[model samples]
Target: MSSEQLAIRIEGLSKHFSVYHSPLERLKHVVFPGRTKGFNDFRALNNVSLSVKRGETCAIVGQNGSGKSTLLQILCGTLRATEGTIEVNGRIAALLELGAGFNADFTGRENVYMNGAVLGLTRAQIDERFADIEAFAEIGDFMDQPVKTYSSGMYVRLAFSVAIHVDPQILIVDEALAVGDSRFQAKCLNRIKAMKAEGVTILFVSHDVGAVRTLCERALWLDKGNVRMLGDAFSVTAQYNQFLFEADNEAVPTSAPKQIEESIPQENSAEPPDAQQAMKLHRPINHWGSHVGSIIEAGIFNQQGERSSVYTAGEPLTVRIRFEPPDHADRNTMSVAFSMKDLRGTDLIVSTTWDQNPTGFAAGNGPLVAEFRLPNHLNAGDYLLAVALEDRSGVLPQYYEYIEGAHYFSSLTEKKQYGTFLAQVSQSVHA
Candidate 1:
């Protein structure tokens, strides 16, 4: 990418703070500065470097106190780095700390104008997009109420609404969606999707691994004020999750055979079962556990029970999954389940053996098949199927094998529908 196409560039970035043991030490340092050793240097960021291309979505993830927040604050110009050379190419709008820029005494509507101005929008521009912001926030008459009286969700709603409406070339989000309800979160995600399509550069930070994997193309894993890994979102997030599961001080292997240049998505395919399959383009971001029992094969079947990667909406669909059991496996403790989610990571349907079919399985002598049937009520779109095998005999449930993006299928509709769900309707006019 050309330099003009770079949204952000940084080299040797670091931040340090001087910490004093007590008030006496602070006073001594001021009175007899040269004679006293009163402060210790605490490094929040240490020699970090990264780049993000224009219109790309990148994610920063790490444990608490790992400088993820500090990095975003520096990018948004809220905090200054102690040592670094930074370059930015466009206007930036950020929702960093909660109520960071809002005036608690002012109403939500008043803060909208103020925040928009801070983001480099004129009064006229704010006025033009005021309605859109309000609608997107959906806080109702709360817009007229003082921000101090608003709840956490209301605060985030107004904050995110203003940030997105300012039309900045770069947007920075720092775990703001965690405050909103599920529906509001989905709305915000959809809005983020729209912004990305318009070539808006995004820098997101969140503990929600699934959200990070779904929204970001590239990921940067920060460990103790240092770069742990930098590569494709799925790859980095998968390795980070493994590290968390281990919870050991030793670092997990993060090296990949090939790095994805500029974090572009990879094409994926699944072989057809019998008949010729349609052009199936998308690939599942598969991450599995190191359990003894593993998913050997997973397939999508049509009404005629033929393997397919595509199906029509309102038609019969089934997901047939087969698993290989480990040696001396206790089948009585096993449970199988699956869930379907749309492209945006919205959970559409979740089915489990305990809820649907609670049956004990045979021994580990042979392969086991778990089939799920659906009425095909999903709207026309791309979807992913995730399957899990759990052991529920103990006090705490254990995931024997959990595979996501295990299979993918597209639903075709005879008539265009609006949302991700399909519902039957009947109407009659009275004369």
Candidate 2:
């Protein structure tokens, strides 16, 4: 059989949870098995079926409570499936949680053997791989100390290093790959790549669609315990993201959300998907903010209307904002503002263009752009350009975007620090 030949098969899989009352209900269960605690039961996984072939990298994705972790736990045998069947033909190594299976009281070396043997490695096999695992973990002298004494970073290092070197035929990895530092994450990702090269089948689960897009060939998306999609990683991720927005009301803008699993279509269904063949980075998705008055579209450009990919510090970056009024405004007043913020949505810029400079709008819809030139003496980082047209002026900015990490640029050269939005300055040398 080819590497793509079936390594694992799933059919009619599902799981459910009790509604909002699981905690009280669990207590009741211990006291009274016959009487249920809550009026409604939450169905976590509904009829879901999927397949994975040998040497394939498959990812599971969804928002919280979307049954992603539930499915992975079932596959890892930590949780029993409420229904359906899963079949696999391979020796397996699983990383279901961060720092799982290690006794905090035990040393790293002891936990390594315990974890290795749980994967069915013989003592000799564990010994042979032990040195490599230790070096990869890079915990140094801490390996001899109890795990509880280790930092969270150290815990992740030891846990991840032990799991990867077991040489299993199939690797089931949850989000544990994200626990360590960026450099360690790069290292672990490289190892996953090496495993893929060596024909190891992998089933990965993560909320990080970027990592899933970068690592996996195919993907499965679950929503409220039912299988929403099983297709190319990008396509399924997009659908999963849509459900995430629907599930969370606070997940505003709908186009983008925090830790969003944004996606485009995959170029191929049959071959293992590569990130280059996965999706276009630029998205055509339009956005709407909380607005009594309306601002429909937002776009980025230069003054010439031609789009340029690269912008230098202290140069000019222009953004065009489009809007219209449903009815004639009594005041007919609005504000268009731009802010530079990090990915976390923290306010880096408390300033707006309209407050300082003036732009006028007539009754109906028209194309209007507020422009700001890049100042040279700024930090290097990514930023979002936010513009809005509110019903009222200076008081309350109603129609707000917080456009969710829209425009991003980097410093061509980093002289001192890791930051965006360089400080605006003027010179008056000790005269």
Candidate 3:
């Protein structure tokens, strides 16, 4: 890509810090150049190179101490690189730390002006955006209070609000949103989505693999201060998750299942099944297991036993799953599980047959079917279904097949719903 198409670029980037044991050792090393060798070199990042295109959203993912923060610090100019060249071609707004640029003694209002000024905004520009920033923060009367008295959530709220309202060309965030409440986090994510639509370049660090897959088009995985993988978000996150599962000694699928072309049969229906819905059931975003068994077909059905993806609140819904069993496996030691998650990947409900039946049940060797029936209490929104099969015979439960994004559905409600799921309640007046 041309230089004009790139927002940030780095070549041979590296950062190293000198570790000193004590103050006396540091003083000794400074005073005696040749005799004292009291410090060791710790490399935080080594020969890292990446380029983020203009208007592209990219994510940085890894465990702690993996140089994620170090790289972000360098990109934001909070820390200098030990070696390499860097180029950033945009007006940058970064939320790298909590209250990073705020003065504890100053009120939130004053800090807003300071942060705006640091971002190359004029006093008039800050004035123009102050109302929107204050409204987004939702700190109410606390906006005029000293930041030192503010809670961690309040601090992050105000900081994130200011960062977004500044109209930055390139936005950088480093796990700052994790401190906010669920509602506020959802609000921030929506705003980020809006920003991405407006062609803003975004570089964020998040451990939430679901968020990475949903928000970013590409991902970079850092491991031990080196670039482990950098590619499409889905593929990179899949590999990363597999790596973690293996590191924990968990059972992961050894091989991909044979392609099954059969569609989920709709029972007692006059119309044929939808091809798109049928395709999604077999194409899970992330699939893993021991290959001992696999879900061949799955779908959501209505009361009439018709395959449907849309349902109304308080209606009967059933999740049907069919799987091929491993040869000679004892049916008494098997379990089936499924989870319902919202678009942001929050688990609204999780159920497993093993929870009720510890010993499992007896079944035949043919394809096994499991059906989960429940009232549709989920609030109005789109959702994804994940399914898993496990072997309980071992000391620890070993998953035979785990499929994420196995199916998609939506729930509609006429009553006002406040959260992920609706609750049954009755009101009584006593006066």
Candidate 4:
């Protein structure tokens, strides 16, 4: 692609740090030169390459030691890469470590001008935007106080306010927004959405998968000094989540489940319906777990026990999940769960069989079916379903079969609903 079409481009980027055992060993190494070897080289990033278009928003996800911060620091020009070339086409504004560029001795107001100057804003520009920054920060009297007296949330509020109001062409955030309260975080997200709409290139680092899927178009998953996966936000985050789940359980399945045919079976027949027929797996469907058991079929049905994908508000609904049971699997340790999520992938409701049947159910020779019945309290919107079969025998639950986007449904109502769900209310007002 042409240089003008891209906001950020990197090639063969790498960073290495030298580790010294002690001060004496470092001195010996410095004094002896070729005679002494006292340090080991640690690579934080290895030959990483990426390209982001001018108006695209991308997210970076990884564990603590997975080089996520190192990559961001390099992009923000706070750290140097040992090898490779980087091209950043536009002016960059970064929110890295909390209180990174702030002077503790200076009041919030002074810090604002200083930060603005550092970002290449002249005194006139800073004066023109100071009022908006102050109002957005919402620090009130604290704005006149030294930063030393400010809370963590206050620091993030001021930093984020200045970073956004400066009219940056490129924005880089490194999880600093997580320190803010829920309301402030929501406000920040809405502002970010506005920025995205205005074609500001954004690179966000966050552990919240839901946020990544909701805000970003693409995501990069980093592992120990390497790129594990890079693709659309939803698919990349789904794979990352599965890796975490399996790693926590420390169990690798011997084999994967057999793929089912695409034909749908009769509801009254003994055979289970095909998963593909219940919902359109338009995008990739993620299924991962031990091969001991698997979800053969899943569907959402109405009160008449007929398959349906659309429901009226307050109507009765049933979710049926059919799966094979592992041989000699412990009944007490096995459980089934299903969750409802909005189209954006935010979880709205979750129900588990183990919550009701703590003692567990009996083992059967044939395929077992679990049905979850509940009233449709969801507002008028499209939704997705996720189901899982887990074995809780160990310290961490081991998933036997976890299927994401197993089914899709929609709810409709004549009355306008306010939020995600409709809550039952009984009220009387006195004049």
User: Which of the numbered candidates is closest to the native, going by highest lDDT?
Assistant: 4
The collision pairs in model 4 are: none
**Candidate 1 — which residues are off by over 4 angstroms?**
26-41, 131-135, 138-145, 248-287, 293-333, 338-350, 358-367, 373-386, 392-397, 404-431
How well is each residue in 177-253 modelled by candidate 2, as lDDT tens digits? 67688999889889988998999999888777667766787898776777766777755664555344444436434
Q: What is the lDDT of residue 40 in candidate 2?
A: 70
lDDT digits (tens) for residues 1-431 of candidate 4: 99999999989999998788889888988888766677888999998888999989999999889998899899888899999999999988888888688999999999999999999999999999999999999999999999999999999999999999999999998999999999999999999899999999999999999889889988888899898888777667877888897777575534544654232222232222222433453322466677623677776789898877799998999988887776666777888989887755667989889888865568667678899999999999878788888886776667887776777788999888698888788999999
TM per model? 0.71, 0.61, 0.71, 0.82
Cα lDDT of model 1 overall? 0.77
lDDT of 4: 0.83
**Candidates 1 and 2 compared by lDDT, better number:** 1
Residue pairs clashing, model 3: 252-289, 253-289
Between candidates 2 and 4, the one scoring higher on TM-score is: 4
Clashes (backbone N, CA, C under 3 Å), per candidate, total 0, 12, 2, 0
Better of 1 and 4 by TM-score: 4
Ranked candidates (TM-score, high to low): 4, 1, 3, 2
Global lDDT scores for all candidate models: 0.77, 0.65, 0.82, 0.83
| Pairs clashing within candidate 1 | none
lDDT of 2 at 124: 99
lDDT tens digits, residues 267-295, model 1?
A: 23332111012114334354434462356
